[model samples]
Target: MDMSVTFGDDSVAAAAAEAARKLAEEGVPRALADGDATLWGGEAESEAAIRLGWLSLPITSRELLPEIGKLVERVRAESLEHVVLAGMGGSSLAPEVICASADVPLTVLDTTDPGQVRRALADRLDRTVVVVSSKSGSTVETDSHRRIYEKAFRDAGIDPADRIVVVTDPGSPLEQSAIEAGYTVILADPNVGGRYSALTAFGLVPSALAGADVTRLLDDAAQAREQLGADDEPGLLLGTAIGSAAASGRDKLLLDDSLSDINGLPDWIEQLIAESTGKQGRGVLPVAGSEPNEAGDELVAGIDTEGDIEVHAPLGAQFLIWEYATAVAGRLLGINPFDQPNVAESKENTTRILGEAGDGPLPTGTPALVDGPVEVYGDLPPHAKDLSDVLTAVLQDIPDRGYLAILAYLDREAAFDVPVPPEASFETITDIWAAHDPASLQGLLAIRTDRPVTFGWGPRYLHSTGQYHKGGPQNGVFLQITGAVTDDLDVPGKPYTLGRLQLAQALGDLDALRQRGRPAVRLHLTDREAGVRHLLAAAREV
Candidate 1:
């Protein structure tokens, strides 16, 4: 498809079309010649791969199902309870997806929430299974989690040795740790990226947790991959057509609602697409989900007027369209799409922290707090009693952090505890309190501290508080929470009804905030029975 496919901007399309023809005539599969404004720099590096016909179909040659099945069986035989996964980016995103899709209930200590860590371990202890996952066997967040688990297991009287599983490269330090600690180990495929690891061990942990039919999920993914190879990939042509428009001075944006568990999956895809295809000045501006209703229109303003928005459903099949869109966009703009700028520093950061070789101290204890009044707002649900009942109990029972600020819009309230000493037992209590809240029908309390808390919130909350969360500030730790994928609102039936769209927008905003590096966590439910019980478990104790 050449560049004539645009939204009535014929001149730009004509320009792109002329460039496309020239590149084709020069024996290029899909590349722009000198000074073309449509191709990205990253794609240039992969010109050889494109020329060798490696970019057309089946970008990978790995088979992951068998390995996942074996992992599941091993967990089942061990009678494992909770699962704490270690990994960041792609390695972690896939497992997050499995957790979202699974049929059974499983607790994921995915984010770096000390409260989450404490709560996850407190009740289960020896019964919990820790899965340390990193493609390079060196993700900092994963490594930190591993160390925390080590401390937790020791405190809980559990043999961290038997309860741990290492998923990484074949002969890395993580593998060595697992071996020395007497934990089971699994190696990630060398060829897979962190984001791509979901179909592998990344997906296996949650699948096993939920007791999902791994074979079926993998079968679906395999089918989706095959469809991408075929001519039927839903948005492939549409996206490519959009790319043509982008090359013609039309920037693009992607509105996707798939793989919401990995809070920042869309953002990750955005980089993969944008960096790979944004050539010269011609590229797509990627946006996922809506944090607040207003933010969408803000981003939409710039792109929709000149470019197009490609909407995607939550299925693996649609990924092909984005991939192709990037490929074509890169060629039209004369840019390479694979070379990432400053990506090495990111990788190095992950490794240094995981290995505890970084310049900063491994942060622990309560975060430092600035003296101020803690304003309490928002009406407590009728059943929640009063502010003190919610605040004191929550603050006391939930995990404790050094600094905490709670803001509610309805009422003006503040707590000036002169030099409130940091609580020692902050971690586990907070997790229990969080899991226990919804049952009591308590108004939620979102706490933030100036500490690194690894988390990923799914897309569901983007429509609600996503805007304030992201545009606000980098102060305090953030935990964006949501439930698993279930019955979605039937938007078609209620075109004017905004409930469904609002839900999706909240999810999208959540995705945006996560992309900016905020931590997120999602709780999935098969039904209300256990979920309600778990969410409200803290209330009973109170």
Candidate 2:
């Protein structure tokens, strides 16, 4: 696959060239070759384990292709009708991209939303093979999903072990659990971080199961790897472009792909770049699936994958290129690419909240109904009258080089019901949130605030953008929205329902933001549609 990058203007191009020159002078190539962490920052030694593993993934994946191929065939021959992947962030995103373009049937269950969980396990329990994927066996969301499905299979008079597979690092608790449970286990390289494991078993196993050509994918990645090692590498050039643009005040990366088929590619890249580089008060923000902007502070990189094949070589190449470029961009930004210092804050908060649930009722602030179904929790910031007002206020408070992030805990499909039947098609339940047409809301916010607006779905975003929001710069102004989960689904043996889990995640994240002194507010809405209308009205008011 051939990859090319063109800058928006001559100044951006010149900046990239200078950044590349500096990287060469700083001995980045040698550092990468020798697995030195100096390029990351002063704390390279501490983050060495996670940072160096991804460097060799392309080569390692190539060597493992045959084994992966055999495993794929074994699963296919079992005649499973659907393969469900339960994971989050790095463990799930790459498989999602492959499933989108492949011939095999696959469904990804990353959200703890009971509705989504039910949808994924609804029908076809006997014929469905569930891939419980997590780099660390202990991801709460993934474990919750695994348990839910385990009970579902038991209820259906099926052996959960017969239909289960595990993908995780060796010796992780999840590996032992899978082994004890009699499920097939695939051990991933311990050194590869979740975001950088797309070419490893984490990504390849699912791609192969989806009937995607894993060989072609890895072959393409190998080609890109060769290019990355060259003196005038595209990865370095692109990284220079990104780093240079960020340095020149165009830190917002507006990524575009001409092929609609490869849209998910950008979503995966968003997490890769955002989580990897967005930290230590300086980072590159990737804008995907949002309105096009020509702001002076924006740098647009268009990806044109002109043709479609069973195996998306271009997409595979892109995975490698971005990984390389993001590392390069990290070196330029003077931050450790592998360490997510703030991501654990929210997780810890969520764990604490969950553990203390027995201490008392979950805290709920007095709800103040704004216009329509919109309601404000606790105290609204001064000058904020409604949901829209609160959002507008947050937008106004964005600092220089800051971005506005909307964290909505509402159901993505707006269906408040629980435990959708197993026979229902996954598509019927995975509809994009309609209440606040995200694209329209994003465009309005961009025009009004003249800053990037990122829309993150509940719990799911916690795994992806949450790292950047808390660990990156302090420039973000967050608007967290929570709503009533009318119907709740229990996790069989667990004490809480999926609805409770979702709310806990939201509250925990909101609390973490406040603790960090980040400007943020929580709005609890009584109705999804009314909440959205009120939000749009507020944007119009501005």
Candidate 3:
């Protein structure tokens, strides 16, 4: 599954080899020149990464299962139809994963999307209980969302005090909010990052809703922790591998196919990897959940092209296996994975984005152009029989670095054989949201377009585009394509069919564009991503 390419003078082979060497040595407990083994940084950059991997091991006791069970029961007993977890990053994502995997109907709002908040409140509010989740209780997003929920309840005529819940450290700001609100507070175990919090309240929300065999989950987690933490077992080996990799200037990229199954996990992994290892201008990347995606290739190209050391962790990978691999890698590289140094970027971005509005709206500056525009539209005039020819023609016509956001709405069966624009080639494409791996994808698109162009799916784009596209300049040229899926799932009682719903959303978004006095063109396709690619090729031909 490993491929090598010779791009100019960049020798990825050597870079990759050195990274591998670092991963190999990180685990051995070595005395430093300063006479400290565990006291100072290790050999591998992945050392810290490997170290962080151990936290996933579940080492809790059977004795604690009952406490968790009772907590679940209490949530049910409170006549709460839905629990709103209000934490950011790791604290909130684990629970969201549980919900998605169990396919529960309960709503979990993990983002600060006003539209999402509005939907949650409109649907739940009086009927559902809200869980405000924040481990530190000081996460700005968590607090901001909490305020949103508070205002929502107040507006809905519900006593804000009675409608909300808080989950956080015992004395955190979130806990204070819960106290002042007169609602239930779930005190999560300290020492766990928001991502690791999944084992705690992070896992509880969905467990309570979907009746997940959390007892079994906890058992698995506990087993992972116990087995990995052992002094001489795979834990040591894995830790060594991680340490080695980090020291050698090689980073870790966690590739999990279970990403879609575990909703919100990709984001959690990003935060964990960024915060845990990105200290002192170095760190391992935990890349998860870009399965069956076009974005994957672009991501790999970015790394392999630049010769960034990487480790791809597949779905359902053994916890110990990864631990040992990373540990050994870190030892070879020389760094710590336990500390978060560059975590300020996210906060800074958020602050800047929020500040730009200054009580007005998010400023939409010029969009970054990385992925040159590929004519990924499926529906096109001047149709041709040979798709390849069409694709070549379409690609030749567009700007070199534009991203064509495709939307065919076509079902899987009907869209299997669609042709891709020549420029539409990607190193990877995940089934999940492409935006989650913002840094990786952004890097890829940057390289492709010599600018940054992004592809966004529906529902999510509606929330994110308002400030950027409308408030900002016409940096992004939206394709706004639509198509029909072969088979549609019809849920009874819904106002519109899913197909119609897609069209409506597209229209609504286009209307938003028009309101901004922006110009957008819509292309109708027979398939979603597939036909869009096909049409992109066709457009190039013209």
Candidate 4:
């Protein structure tokens, strides 16, 4: 099993084979390889025309090798060996997998949580070199991170230009500002979108600095390039199988990466699949980091796990393959894979909420019910008794064929210090959730329902599956978990603090979900640790 995808020999596989045959006859493989925007019809042309740059990344990204290597050597020579990646979504997710697979340590700051940001700021400030990456350069979270790090570097008597490297599109705001600031700037291909940019500078820069063999990663991707363009190839078969299954009502994609040599690939796949195809109220919902169950409306795929629809690949090729397959899947779903129209709803709401709030505290509404350390915020039934009742109501609200999304806007690394049992372990929220019903809020809630459960750290998922929750199908009930920031960290030049930003983001997304008439419940942990314990206890009761 090497950089290939094999479907089952049953009727399901036969149907997929037929879909692939039809697609090949329709010239999908060749058109996709040729970067033809017309493959997705007229509506997707403008975005698709540019977003297809990922197809050429394997060949085009190699030119950055010499410069990146030289930069790494210079940084290490200056004793700046600690690589802190200040990026969100595609900027952060790919290097995480690369560094994890290479067994190298890379501190990825992709959160607005005060504790998480403070933790990153406190760690190895002297030897740290921050890689600030943003495709659009206007991402609030990344911008915030850049500002704080610049302040920290300046306060430490170190010039930010020597300690910071910027990765953005050639003319992005960050690039222009970084050039003026005298910081090292690495321009990503302007043609590629954030989620589809694993092979671009956004992925390569951070991983190379962290001592990963990024050159080998590109080499592996190139090896699979020719195969992806031909009929009956892994990319074609995979795209058609998953796409057609989804078109036939199996819209929930159950991804299992347990047997893969690639570390933390599912999250990347989750963002890729969810953000790309999840729009126009139609998309494939990627249910990753869960115990794969044989559900009626779900398609279970394993990365290197020998079962139905077996997918095996090097981490590099894995990124390219899944990306191409997702594009094909989007074609079948009749949605633009390149555009994320609904993702900005939350961001716009956040901005509006923040702007309206100004320096004053964000509007805090009364909770529907206060149970122990937890304050439940939602339109729950009036007769509901306690937290368990709220849990029951939320779980019951999940319609048949619907899924549960637990979006935690708290510090993602809050659980990093805890110990895991020998059977399972995890590095970060970017890593997979333990499938063995581990003592987690998601695991506990999962036991109460049979529907697919997904866990995402907020602001991070805002760039990933955030699109799906708003633009995808209506069959999703969200459980938003926000916690009280014990010690808030203030952003250097912003009117809002990190804790406030996190809360506003959570509230903004909640408002958007409610506006869509989606069933959403917000549980605020007024006492972070105690609330977590009580929430878990209530989930267990349910």
| Candidate 4 residue pairs in clash (backbone atoms < 3 Å) | none
Off by over 4 Å in 1: 1-62, 103-110, 227-235, 238-285, 291-314, 319-336, 344-542
- 2 or 4, greater by TM-score: 4
Which candidate achieves the best lDDT against the true structure?
4
Compute the lDDT of residue 112 as modeled in candidate 1: 36
Q: What tens-digit string does per-residue lDDT give for candidate 3 at 361-471?
A: 323222222112222223333543354443333333333322323222222222323344555436422322232222222233223332223344443333222223443
Question: lDDT scores for all predictions?
Answer: 0.41, 0.75, 0.43, 0.87
Greater-TM-score candidate between 1 and 3? 3
Task: Give the per-residue lDDT digits (tens) of candidate 4, residues 1-542.
Answer: 37778875375588778988888889889889889989888988988888889999999999999999999999989998789998999999999999999999999999999888888888889999999999999989999999999999999998999999999998888888999999999999999999999999999999999999999999999988878778877777788888888888888888888877778888888999999988888889988778766777878888888556788888888888888888888888788999989988999999999999887878768898999888988889987889999988988989998999999887766756455556664453324332211127777777778898999999899999999999999989999989888899888899888899999999999999989999998889888867777777677788
Q: Per-residue alpha-carbon lDDT of model 1 for 1-542, expressed as tens digits?
A: 11111333344335545544554465443332111323444434444233222232232323545665676677678877566665555555445555554535555543433334445556566667777776566653466567767777777777887777777766877788788878877665553334334455555655555566655544444444444422324333344445565544334343444433323345445444544443333345444432212222112211112333333333333333444445555555555543333234323433333345233433221312211121122222344443234433334422222111221111000011112336636665455444433412222332211111211232211211222234333332332223332323221222211222222333343344346654432222223334444444432444
lDDT of 2 by residue, 285-397 (tens): 88776655567777777676321101133767778778888888887787777777778888898888888886466766566546677666644566666666766667778
Q: Rank the candidates by lDDT, best first.
A: 4, 2, 3, 1
Q: Residue 249 CA error for candidate 1 (Å)?
A: 5.9
> In candidate 3, how many Å is residue 509 off?
24
